[model samples]
Target: MTPITEVEGRRLALSNLDKVLYPATGTTKGEVLHYYAATAAGALLAHLRNRPVSFLRYPDGPDGQRFFTKNPPPGTPSWVRTTAVPHHEDKQARQVVVQDLASLMWAANLVVEFHTPQWQADAPGIADRMVFDLDPGAPATVVECCAVALWLRERLAADGLLAYGKTSGSKGLHLLVPLEPTPADRVSAYAKGLAVEAEQELAELVVRRMTRALRPGKVFVDFSQNAAAKTTATPYTLRARPEPTVSAPVTWAEIDECRAPGKLVFLAGDMGARLKRYGDLLGPLIDPDRAGRLPSAR
Candidate 1:
């Protein structure tokens, strides 16, 4: 494999391309780099544009030590666009924003298996979407989380909002509801209220508590992920798991199909085919004109 990949006139250094990352599938670092590069013009880049990314870098592969990287490391190129997002009222932090294929490939070279982005960006304080992270605890399967996601989708629809569902590419599902430009605080509060309501109606299936001990046998409606600086896996990201699975966007009809175990487990190589079929179900979220707002908390 070449040491430097010329992506759109940018000579990004790509090392150890032949090294295997996913031991189970024998997926090489080169394959991972190509996966993001090939998908850049479609779902991956569209969703990641302008968002500050927190990369889950696994330099020694998935089995080795791993850590989160927000700031650009020693060799980040000047051409890679970035912005200083507000971390707190008194402090700000610079974050990588992948606007081009070279930036995406550069991250891939670092073995950034997962891409997590803040809901709101520094250039725009207004939130892009409100997320309800549906995490299924022990004894509870992704199937249960799917049920809860469908329920949330129904309620959001009742309130004149459209909610999109996707596999977290991990152990659960994530329901993302796109919002017009709104205050981040208000978005967080609204998501919390929505989760509380879901828990109230479906007491058996949903739990809003953050306590891990109390989460057993139930899907936790994690509203806390909507806050500023908090990040969720970007759609089409490759997750670090035994199987080289990806965070995949799905349609309402496909959600039911996902209930079957492993049906929605999208692998890195399977991305292009899926994109050809679905064409980005979450694309509507980027539309600024989508009419959706949180009703006052009850």
Candidate 2:
């Protein structure tokens, strides 16, 4: 049976609160909900505001069945706001917008372990940021990705674009640069160009090719995530891995020190303290005046 709780004057039905979502750590659904509600007023909610979010829900815990849910489930509270966004090019789907703490808590009740939000907010089909998902192939470690990320940072800085980095919370790192809301096509082109340049500079360490056969032991610079409707895990969201790891924002110095796997792992409980230290290093990316237009990647 589930228990009902009132959050922000709205009733929320929480189920399986005691169920262990992370088998290795024995983390419970209750802890997950508490983390979101606790972080809602700070770094987490600031990035989520007005963005259409897709949840990766694990109904039977992280080890069991999971599904990607974009639309709010049937019987969602009227107070839980949603925005109509295009899906599959045929029609529109209503995606939840985490506008308040209550809504954040509501999603946690559904056992959502991963928060994947579209790149664009408020303006659909237009992207406000360009992201490069640096995925390291097996036998290749996070250390290799860190080196490439540092290189990418230098390259972007030379071009006058600011880049921010965060762990993917699963097995890789993501580097993002804010851009003046440009057409998704243009954003994709700019990202691909940058990826190609990186590949040329570090031919052995980075691979622009997406073919699996060629990716072994190389860091894949995935520029394709810049497309419209494509989503990346939101910062501070927990991954449904064997352990309850979080997609944590990090400093360049920290990335340089990340010599091995599990060294940079951030659990849900560590988020508050991270907020205290980092104070949202990515916040300036969202500032209208701070984000600049993409320079020709040619």
Residue-level lDDT of model 1, residues 1-298, one tens digit each, is: 5586688898877888888888899988888877887763567888888888888887777788989878777778888887877565535667788887777787778887545443546535567688888998988888888888888888889888899988898888988888776777888888888889999999999899989988999999998777776788888888888777888887777777565657767788777887888789888888877748777666
lDDT of 1 at 92: 66
For model 2, give the 10-residue run with minimal summed lDDT: 113-122
What are the per-model numbers of colliding residue pairs? Answer: 0, 0
Which runs of model 2 end up more than 4 angstroms from their true locations? 87-89, 114-118
Q: Which stretches of candidate 1 lie over 4 Å from their true place?
A: 89-92, 114-124
Lowest summed lDDT over 10 consecutive residues: which window, candidate 1? 114-123
Error of 2 at 279 (Å): 1.6
| lDDT tens digits by residue: candidate 2, 1-298 | 6798998899888888887888798888888788887763567777788888888987677779989888788778899888888667547678888878888888778777545543545789788888889999989978889999999998888878888899999889999888888888898887888899999999999999899998989999999888886888888888888887888898989898888877777888877888887788778767877676778645
